[model samples]
Target chain A: MPSFDLDSYLQTQVERVEQLLRSRSDEMGVQVPPRLLESMRYSLLAGGKRLRPVLCLAFAEAVLKQSNVPRMVEDCACALEFIHTYSLVHDDLPSMDNDDMRRGRPTNHKVYGEAMAILAGDSLLTDAFALVAGGPEPVRGVLCRELAVASGSSGMVGGQVLDIAEDRPAHIDYLTRMHRLKTGALIRAACRMGVLAAGGDADALARADVYGDSVGLAFQIADDVLDVTGDASSMGKPVGADAAAGRFTFPAVLGLEESKQLAARKVAEAIDAVKTLEPHDGPLAALARYSVERRS
Target chain B: MPSFDLDSYLQTQVERVEQLLRSRSDEMGVQVPPRLLESMRYSLLAGGKRLRPVLCLAFAEAVLKQSNVPRMVEDCACALEFIHTYSLVHDDLPSMDNDDMRRGRPTNHKVYGEAMAILAGDSLLTDAFALVAGGPEPVRGVLCRELAVASGSSGMVGGQVLDIAEDRPAHIDYLTRMHRLKTGALIRAACRMGVLAAGGDADALARADVYGDSVGLAFQIADDVLDVTGDASSMGKPVGADAAAGRFTFPAVLGLEESKQLAARKVAEAIDAVKTLEPHDGPLAALARYSVERRS
Candidate 1:
């Protein structure tokens, strides 16, 4: 119905990426900070779509061979996921979302308590870079730059600043800008990094960046839609929480009908962005559609 | 003359370091998140021995003819200090150390509240890597690895695990080992990074690491000594707070007299570690003495 089986394809690729990341976690089984490592795993392995890492992998495959990034990619993807999880953990704290449940389980602060939740989030964010930092100097250096750009001012964390400020405002421009940085920066980085890790070309990187940016916006809008118009049981968390926050979102600003149309337009742009690449056939095509159409 | 003129030397260097950090806080300038950036400056400019960066500069001179890190040094040094300050902020959070004050001001969480404190800490930590990432790839890569090792499980964070787990009672050897990883890891990384940044030889790196390790332990003991013997006035924070938390220290495990003796021995080892370098004098020697004796 959506011109492709988005769910099965995404689920398959996401599983592959998750399995790869899980392997790296096993290898990083260092001794001293056993509990620290355990806590990291608790948050990391908590099930999600693995969307970010798969995008990284699928993009890298456009340039690199499929099997080339077994070790490095896992750590890179794991670090990104850690950043995402840490944000969710902190954002759900009483001072923020006051969410008690996530991924159908107790939120980190709920399970670990507020203090541990705070510390756990802190450690995960710090360790995200540290995870990549332990590698060879050149690769680690390049990877650090890639990740720093993704996570810093012009990237995900910067978006967070705008997002919090938007809780009161109703401006569409501010909302788009916030969504660009908050969600788009990391997703773009993940795509670009996949190329970097696998020695992809400049052209590929540029195209993927465009694709990732478009889809990142589209994906967040989908989130807004699900939040307002989703089923609680199927979504695994509260659906209308965003509206309840009286916060900015696509639907909040553009109305539900327009929000859906905008998401589809962005998805179309993302698909067209990669259409020129001959090697961009499999996962990349599937990914653009999945970004817009996935239910969860 | 109290063996060495540590007070005068420390005063000038600490002031210089604080000044350097404050000015560079604005280097990323108006684009940075205002409150988050201000919080970063608040902690970085807070007075302390600029031991980490000084060690960096010392090792830079000791390893090569640079005499000082280039203009870029300030940004990177301040970045390292930011990482340190962020760790302290998070460590002192309710989930971690639960300390109420740091560097004479209400700890970040106390002033900004927990959510901001957590985000502030996350901002600093991520931005630290962002600074390095944006720098020259080769230098940034090596520096990133050095920092990652220090910040992660094998280092400071790992030491933190040992700190909390060892909070009750454990083998003295275990406690000491934990402290080395926790505090010593980053301090050692700071020195090692100066060499990496300067493109020095293995021999210089080895000496710096050894010196850093010994001085790191001595620094902790001086902290313990101050916890018991110094005042809240000079220290700028509550004294005897560690004992209240049931955390162990050199004085707690060994008597005050024995702790002082051990401190002296560690200092001797630190001095010897760096003495092999050609033509060593001034700040490095003064720092060794200061590490064992600083009141705050």
Candidate 2:
């Protein structure tokens, strides 16, 4: 009867993710060197939108038509977050993006030395598998495969390579392909993993896959738009760095107006795809809209 | 009727691992960017002893008492090699060990650039899980857990942190613990994963564990001895770099004679532990001896 307040939903879910990450770090065992653990916790616990984990949990809830999803869903969500954090840590390294600031604070390498940051990222990536491997059988292997395939050379890492390539073509198709692999792959995995974790049927999984594809592209377009138009304070990192570095983004490839229109259309597709899974004005629809409308 | 020839056994296993690595890279999908795939293949196909994969396959054969292990065993073996290769790539990074050469060739970064090399290492690590996750259901999860835990924060990465720590204690216990995690964990996993993939019983797994622990320690001590006494051409990498960097190695902590004695003792322990798992003069015992006798 009441309206589904997306803000409150996100806050509650973010808190849950934070708690899980904290507990998981604590449970990493006494044998985990203190400094390595500290470096890992620093970026892992650093505040972000928690987009991947939230999307994973949301899909699970929507598929089950209930809020109380299984522990497998939580495990999948945590693994997604861990993978996301590791990517960020590595992407921000001096040899990569050379990012000095992230999430309104100094990057991992700035706080911990570059070597420790690399190890922290490595530990996070490895530990994500450890966490998912502990999930209940049948689905656990699926979860591991999903997470790995989405993040490995053919996916996120592939996207990174394209992004940094000196001879990349400047075309909308190339841009789309790059984003699809880099950011879209993991986002899609998050949604699909949620469905798998909740034992959703084939139809549900297919719908989730469609919804994820749309939202993932939309999210990257929105990110490109924000880099051009949004303020640095809200984003926690400098704006326009992508353009300055001559990075191929939607706004750069297409006109700003065209990019915005494409994002809006993609969001609409995302919402329509998830209609069977949730009500018209449900969190899924709201999230699609938020993908483009969010300031940071 | 023929003697267990360690040389021929290693050559045959190494070839199998190399073939798998090549095929796996080819099948990573065309969606994978060319540069990323090239970088990944560079270090992955680069010749080493293929020790981890060979060890994994050997244990699987020893447990099954046949040369024809399952596809799962091969998959786990490749995964182990992938992890080992990734660790080497990262360890050779400028921010980490800063080595310009590895396996008698230019390091990954030298060929592919630093950013590409990092991504290559990352892709290798993530794809390792993907490889194992494709194994048969229940055992796949266990394989994932074993590989992850052995290579994660509480294992190899943790050991790396200790190795690089500025204030690390200079004691035998500290050195042992560091090696136990960094090198020993993956070696132990190599043995255990082989047994699991072969569907060996718990007792077999336990024996593999003991054998792994002893050989792992012996391997490190031998490595330390090699660094101090072995030739660079034979070892592929420069010798005495560890001592030059003031690394806490066996030869540095204990005297050279004491380190050699300790290695011999560990090799004896390793051979003794595996007597129940393999014939008295089997490949397992030969491998234990090889752990100390190898030039590289």
Candidate 3:
């Protein structure tokens, strides 16, 4: 098969995600209070790379070898985006990261007040389960369990706890574990959910796990590198805020060159991990490469 | 049949719930940062009425006429408490109600700092779904869907948004709707889930809904009354907090006497709603009356 067009595939998937998210936001407006819905919609619709959901959809395609993404797969992808967005909203709260801006716009708490921001985050998190539970019956339990485990205490939230507790760099092992739970967990879940959606077997699930873990770590390291080198105009947030906040980042723990080399190695591992799903795995391979190569 | 001892039943059920919660908290401690788990346990195990879980267990018994609570039923009860605790933690955030004390102890944020407190809340909410998803396969989807809808944007969170929006008393209809979604949704879910867990039919579920809705409203109205008349020591927190916050409470919207009368009528209706369950529903019936009678 011809080499995959990574840009084209991502653009198509992103548009699909935006449309689903927009319709869901409109539905929420009718059901919830205007300002509350506005706060939720404000952050959710604010455009980002839609990277997690894209990976979910791409993985489903690779595993199923199907041209059309199933409705359940799309819904699961949307759920991933919602979970990611909610985490960002809560992470940007005044008490958390205290981030004033995100995705080139005022953060959720900045746009709506702190109370509404917190509620908006709660709503998004709850609604994500509602979305996944709407998937096909056979996989609903698995999907819900995966997403919850990936996003819950021992996963994303646990990582954030460690991140906040980091007064000083303790050890490289600690930082690696923190990033794996904080960012890697959900990224890993996105791929795993895709495999589940496509009814992939245990072997396929294991392969997806390997692919996700490598890419998730590579993605975070790349983010650290970008914090050191990327422009704010494209990244849509301050570049050096992590350093200013005394964050223990990849580049901080490892020198810039070393971090870059590590990210490159992880990306290569991610590509290799998905080889079993080849020729349909081109997009997944491209995403792994993009994890390190993207400025944002 | 002999009359059910409501106090004894509640005492036993509450103990069981406490044991489950303690074990779960211990599990979280092992998996997460100590401080994060500490923040969660501080609020979750701080001890309140445990009314929601009791109501859930009672309804399950009413529907199934069982002598002992099943493991799934117990798990569902724990999930309810977890969700309730998370809401309280987030509600106590400085940006939210900003209360310093809860259950006569310092609030989670006060003890853990704002960031850890927020994460603790997120963890609880996420963990609740994880718990429910672990339920029996046949009803796992339904349990997850029901809990998600009742606690999500259009339910409890929506009520909160409305609560914060109310600068003064809105129309009675609006206030009623807000309270129903806010406190009423989860109470209703607690009962509804009980029936679902027992594999009850539509009729059983309808009865649970009616019982939950009436008692939930009565419970909130009674809470409004206690805010005016109860002592802080007995209430485990300051009295008159609602009024001090300028919250549009039931007692504030309606005069004190009117609120008291409404709560009495709601309690009566709640008791009457579960009449179909006959002798088996004695605890549920007594619990409805207790909703308005309790000082805290």
What C-alpha lDDT values do all the predictions have?
0.76, 0.91, 0.88
Candidate 3's residue-wise lDDT over B34-110, tens digit each? 77787888889998999998888888888778858667787788889999999999988898889899899999988
What is the lDDT for B238 in model 2?
A: 85
Residue B77 deviation, candidate 1, in Å? 2.0
**Residues B151-237, candidate 1, lDDT per residue (tens digit)?**
765677777767776344656687678779878888888788877777778988898888888888888888888998999999999
Residue B260 shift from truth in candidate 2, angstroms: 1.2
TM-score of every model versus the real structure: 0.93, 0.98, 0.97
DockQ for candidate 1, C-alpha atoms: 0.59
Task: Supply DockQ values for each candidate.
Answer: 0.59, 0.85, 0.81
Which of candidates 1 and 3 is the stronger one according to DockQ?
3
RMSD in angstroms, candidate 2?
Answer: 1.3
Tens digits of per-residue lDDT, candidate 1, A33-101, equal: 676677667777888887788887777666765646645666777787877878888788887668898
Candidate number of the best lDDT: 2
In candidate 1, which residue ranges exceed 4 Å CA deviation?
A1-5, A65-70, A135-137, A278-281, B1-12, B71-73, B278-280
Give the Å shift of residue A128 in candidate 1: 2.4
TM-score comparison, 2 vs 3, better candidate: 2
Chain B alone, TM-score of each model?
0.91, 0.97, 0.95
TM-score of 2: 0.98
Query: Which lDDT tens digits does candidate 2 get at residues A1-296?
Result: 77779899889999998998788778875679999999999999998988889999999999899989988899889889899999999999999999999999999999999999999999999999999998898899988999999999888988988888999899999999999989999999999999999999999899889888999999999999999999989999889999998878898889899999999999989888888899868998988888899999
